[model samples]
Target: MTSRENCGYSSRTIFAAWVQGNFRIAAGCFWNTLDEFESAVDESYSCEAAETYKQAARDCVAELTVKLNKAGE
Candidate 1:
C-alpha cells in the first residue's frame, strides 16, 4: 500500500467529511493522509518527494481553511 493507490482511503474520508459539512474533520483527514504520504516518502524516497507531497497537502489544507472560514460567515 505504498503506492498512490493507497491515498484513496484518506481522500475518500475528506470527501465524506466535506459532504457532511465537517470542514474541521476534512482538514484533519487531509493531515492524516499527508502524514501517511510523508511516512511512505521517508521510507522509500528522498526529501524531494516528501516536500512535494507536503506542498500538495498544504494546498489541500489551504482550500479547507477557506471553506472553514466561509462556514463561519
Candidate 2:
C-alpha cells in the first residue's frame, strides 16, 4: 500500500496537502538553488534560483516525513 493509504489518508488528500505546503516550498527551493549553483559557476546567477533550491529541499523533507509516517503506519 502507498504511504498515504497506510496512514489512513487518501492519496488525493495527501497529494493535495503535499502540493499546498511542500510542493510550493520545493519548487521555490529548487529554482533558488539552481540560481545559486549557476551563479557559483558563472557569476551571473539570479537570486531566485537559490531560493528555488532552498524550497525544493524543504519540500523534499516534508515529502520524506510523509513517507516515513506512512511507513510507520
Candidate 3:
C-alpha cells in the first residue's frame, strides 16, 4: 500500500542522511517513518499489514535511538 511505499522512501532518506553524518536529519526521517506507521495503524486497526508496518517502524526507532544516543542527540 501507500504506507509501505512511504516507509521505503523514509528509510532511504534516513540512510542517506546517516551516511552523510546528518544525525538530526536522519532522526527526523526516522520520526517521520514512525508517524506514517502510526497513521496506518489508525486507518487500519485490524489489518495484519498495518501491524507489520508498525512493528518495522518500532524496530527502526529502537535501532536509531541507540545510534542517536551515541551521537549525543
Best by lDDT: 3
Across residues 1-73, which tens digit of lDDT does each residue of candidate 3 receive?
1112243323432321133343222223243344554674557455675665566556555566675564455
Q: How does each model score on TM-score? A: 0.41, 0.32, 0.42
lDDT of 1 at 26: 27
How badly does each model clash, as a count of residue pairs?
0, 22, 0
Instruction: Provide the lowest-lDDT 10-residue window in model 3.
Output: 1-10
Cα lDDT of model 2 by residue, 1-73, tens digit: 1112211111111121234333221121223332343343244334664444334444444676676573343
Arrange candidates, best TM-score first.
3, 1, 2
Misplaced by over 4 Å in model 3 are 1-33, 44-46, 70-73
What are the per-model C-alpha RMSD values against the true structure?
A: 8.0, 12.9, 7.9
lDDT of 1: 0.43
lDDT of model 3, residue 12: 33
lDDT against true structure, model 2: 0.34
Task: Give the TM-score (vs. native) of candidate 2.
Answer: 0.32
Order of candidates by lDDT, top first?
3, 1, 2
Candidate 1 TM-score to native? 0.41
